[model samples]
Target: MGPDDPDRPVKLAHAALHRAGEPLAFGGGVLLAPGTVLTCAHVVNQVLDRPDFAQERPGALDLLAVSFPATGRRRLRAALAAWLPARRADGSPAAEGDVEWSGDLALLRLLDDPGPAALPVGTGPCHAGRPAYAWFGSGAPSSIAAVLVQGVTERWIVLDSTGSAQPVVGGYSGSPLWDRAQRRVVGLVVSRSGLRAFAVPAADLRELFEEAGEAVPGPLGVEDGAHGPMDPVARQLLGPLRSVLTTPEALADLAGRFLAELEAEPEPGPEPATGPGDDRAGVDVGANDARADDAAAIDAGAIDAGADGSGADAGFPASAERLVRLATARPHGAPTLLALLAGAARTQEQQSWIATTALRVCPEQFLTAAEHRELLTLLADGTVPDPRRCAAEALPLGPDLEQAHWPEAVAELERYRPRYGRFPQLLRTVEFAAAAAGPGTARGLGAWSEAVAKRLGLAEILLEHRAQARESAERARERGPQRGAPAPVVQVQLWRATGTEHFSYALHAADARGRPLHRSVRDTPVPRSRLLAELGALLEEVTGQVEPGAVPVVEWFVTGEELDLAVDQWVYRPDELFPGVLGQDFLCVMRSPELRRAAFRPEHRYRWQVLRSGRLALVDRQDPVVQQRGAPVPVCGVALCCPAEEVPRLRAIALAVGVPGVLWLRPADHAIPPDRVRELVHGAAPYQLPRLVYEARLTESPDGLHRNLALVWDSPDGHPETLGLGDPRD
Candidate 1:
């Protein structure tokens, strides 16, 4: 075996050490089974956070919390099952002064379901001068550390980081010691003294298990030469998905996104630092990943140098590969990933293959593909569904409800609580990998979904929407700006300092393509009523900046998950003959500086340009089939076709995967006919929406749609920050 095999990562999962807690990682341990971990007894002591050393094994797991560091912060609760304390020559308890001690091995049993891809352990000989590797924990970038075997003692192998990039330090305890030459974990790093570290060899571990009359774990098979192990049946099932892959980079990208979904969302707080043996990375002294110090991480860069030119570690993204291998081996892997992509209607043959090969796979999985697809479909182009809301409660869900009866489908839907960014953020994420799986994946999935939705109990519309959004998301420019000067507009800057949700805004008189109006008054704060009054006065003063006959568009820049701001309801002048509603009086829109901070993505510009051409889609949330009725138009803006409280957020996401103008009515008490609302907002050019609504509001019908109209008209071309949009959070 050669050092730096990309395949080494497959085995990294076996270096399961750490209690499920902060500072990630305990001392390294080799995974013996899906639920069992083996490490040093002292390392276990430290991981439990008992200041003084206790040789006795934990009596129960009630107090234990174990998690693999490479797997983010989610805890995998566990308990100590076996304990072999260090002993002196006379069989007395070993002391710190003892140069050589025996039997410092322990086994841990997981109380929680660890999912698929348990670590596969391989044995390697303990030899001096051999290269060794380890990592602090998982999920973090570049945590691998390399070292060399200095010498072998009676009970331990010594390692030195003399010529390595990083050394064995405080947090490296209990981490698996991978033998670079053998391509398998050879020992557990027991303790460290500055540059020198001590580890119990794999032989010692086997001896510990055997002396207790336990069966020694057999060696796992490694195939594909250096690319590493994969379930053969899974590999067969995914043949189509693999064939459609454009590049290894694409696969890696999907894998990264999948892993990112599992980790904690980035929050405003201090996170533990990186690097092995770093005190904060672990919970206790001598902790490898946590204070247990299970830093069995291998050097990631070493993956670049595999046997056949590809890095051995470069085979698959470690976490994703592990999950695929683990889940699909039981045959649930592919289906779980294909959450919204599965269905017999889309490809009955593919679905049937799993049944034919059911006996062939282990770690079995069951799926309700159509139903899963249905839930996702509803999410794709429509409103956000409450996880607890059931089909029995949905009106006109259509009669195609058979798939909803699929075993565990609704239960699975209820279980889907995503920590990802926003509403369609889930839709975008789930569909990305499926789209890359094969050509027509989007189309096939859409058709099956549509069939289900036609009667809808909701399948077809969702299918089509997901396909369009996903395809468009990819085609959109990742980064760029719109061409030409943005339209004449008034820019509003709403700044709320950290530690508060209340916002303070300023109105700016912006000229097209001019400098960004930067204003943040973190120190001087005002009440909501006073701020709105001041904002109203400022808006009145800035309306003069707008060219004659052009509507004054007020674009407010806000950030984070803030969605409910009554910016449109503010009264510009309460004392005047007409104290007009801000949204009704002018073109008021909300712009997320955080979302648009990168400036205008091509999608933003693409739609903005189309709106310039007067093409807009009128979509009724109640019955949106009209947009699909006629030939597809290059619509740049969308008529929200309903009141503010009524439109699905996915509609906003669908108009443009990046950014596009949206127009709707403010929350209204009375419903208007869809045709009337459409003819009113949809008939006018996208740019003329504000003026049309303004004129209509002054009509004799004071309760008309015009009085309640609201437009989120954001065009990168005429955006407030034609200068620059640098978010304060950035």
Candidate 2:
């Protein structure tokens, strides 16, 4: 085929060959049956030229190496079966003297089937001008299309070479010229001359098979094809379903059609009253007359099997009853078609009908786990009738029921178990509930066996929830968070160093802004509590830092190594020691220099706080002092310059500092001259920043101090939430 035409069907039937001792004897074949192959007779001649074929006759050969031409991954072997040597109609070898070859064919019977796709030989005529596809399994097999020119003889056909872009080459000798419209192989390629090629007609191949006394496979895509006419019993039962499936449609579209069919059919009469202690009054009549009435009811469709297949006197219409019956009967394609219909149902009505029908047919065989889950969902939602009975009967007992809203299912099972008695379904449901309930609950299954023993009257059921409740009560004596006066918010800088054997850390305690309170670096690993004790002692020296009990906020920075240290012995070991110290009151945040430097922009705001003997000092935005010539630029708006690793940090800092419009600088910005910043800040119309800060100027794109700048202040909401993140490096 052409590059775009899908050839998977043809390739599945193609096979290739490799024989011993003949270097130029590469050939191809088509799978004619489960273990049967058809190829050119000349290919067999080339094999006979080798020494390996000298002693072996048909049905006596050891093995012949073969493979799939399309995907030659594994080599397989087939045994020589029979050969129809290239010959004239006069019974002389056609390859000898001046005689021309007519029929050239060879058949092989594989010892082990390689599961190749089988293409039946067509019995119908392959006429001229019809499109034909030739398939081969070469090193690079081609399944290109060609047209049939003419039938040269009964045993040979000529291929139209002008339109056949792909001609018969070395490995194309045994390829089948498949009739695309016919869906069958009509001939096998034998040779090519000038612009034309020749193929052995499938009729002659069939004759050869008959002469060899092998059973001929039937024709394809015809009335006489292999899967024959539908059974009369199945047709009678599935007539309506078959009519719905007669039209070609996708699986998903079948739901609408099936629903339409259901709607068009008449609804069932009202169900007979069924209630506790009333069975004797309505349906039973009298015990002596039961058998005759039941037989009549069955004939009239008054009673049908329930979803559990118990024949439990459930009411259903004649039409629905037959639909379920045929579905269970495997009527023609009913089982497969109904499965597709059930899978495609999207609405509650559709799912309910399909699921209920499948359950009624044979739940154990038909219902999949997902279908069961859907049924359980309906049960939990209080949507279906007699859900408890459905759950106990239709639902499989396992962790499969332990899905969302499982608590409702558990409650249903628990409430109904006693009434269900010793039924296997009910017992299975109880076992499922017990195993599914997770640990540390009063519903612990320690008393399950005891309860069973008590039910059997062998022992008393012991209560197990009391000990668990008492243990929970005793655990209330543990310590709680200290309820003292507020402490000053402390700014802490902790440096962490990783070495060959242990972690060396330095702690720097300070007041909120940058006043140093204490500094110490531990030379050896010490308990975090001991270090906290030493820090508390330093807190007593606290000249200008503390209140009574104000909560402390710590911001820590760690550099040196990344999170991946599985290769090393000395790691952070946070799971053992640091995790406990770092919870709740004591919090540590790690920072990198790249992130900190990127966050340090001049135009943004930074608020400072000071604590002096429990008194507070707070400072708001302070403009940067001019450090350059030619009228130092004022902090008119915010600008963000950060590396890729610090985007989130810069985002938080920009909001924290109350910056105006932001100008994000890339890593490439550092390589640019310092003079470039002047151009970026003041090169454009100088008053643009002032106009944006005060008058709220609008432009096509955001107009800022530089063409490349991002205008955060111009955001439609004028909030940090709308300041969309952008990568400036690109």
- TM values, all candidates: 0.29, 0.29
List model 2 lDDT by residue over 1-730, tens digit each: 3545455545666766666433333666777655677777676655545431222234443435666655444566666666666655545555434224655666776666574334433222344555666754453543454655454444567876576776555566787777665455666787766566788765356656566455544322122211233222222223223223332233114423433332222233333455644422133324354333332332234433334434333322222333333333321223334555544545544434333333222212332223333334433433222323224223222122232354455444433321112222323343323332334221433344334323222232122222322322233223221211123223332333333333344555655323456566555655544545565455445524544433343433333232112111112223555432321323222222322232232222221000000111111222232211112233323333334355334434443333333333223322433233333445322113322222111122232222222233221111111111221111
Candidate 1 runs further than 4 Å off: 1-488, 495-502, 512-525, 544-547, 559-564, 576-581, 593-600, 621-633, 642-646, 672-675, 700-704, 717-730
Evaluated against the true structure, the overall lDDT of model 1 is 0.48
Model 2's number of clashes is: 6
TM-score for predicted model 2 compared with the true structure: 0.29
lDDT per residue for candidate 1 within 90-160, as digits (tens), equals: 46777766656777777777777665645555544454555788665332235567788775665687888
Window of ten residues with lowest summed lDDT in model 2: 608-617
Which runs of model 2 end up more than 4 angstroms from their true locations? 1-5, 21-25, 50-63, 97-99, 115-125, 135-139, 142-147, 212-730
lDDT of 2: 0.40
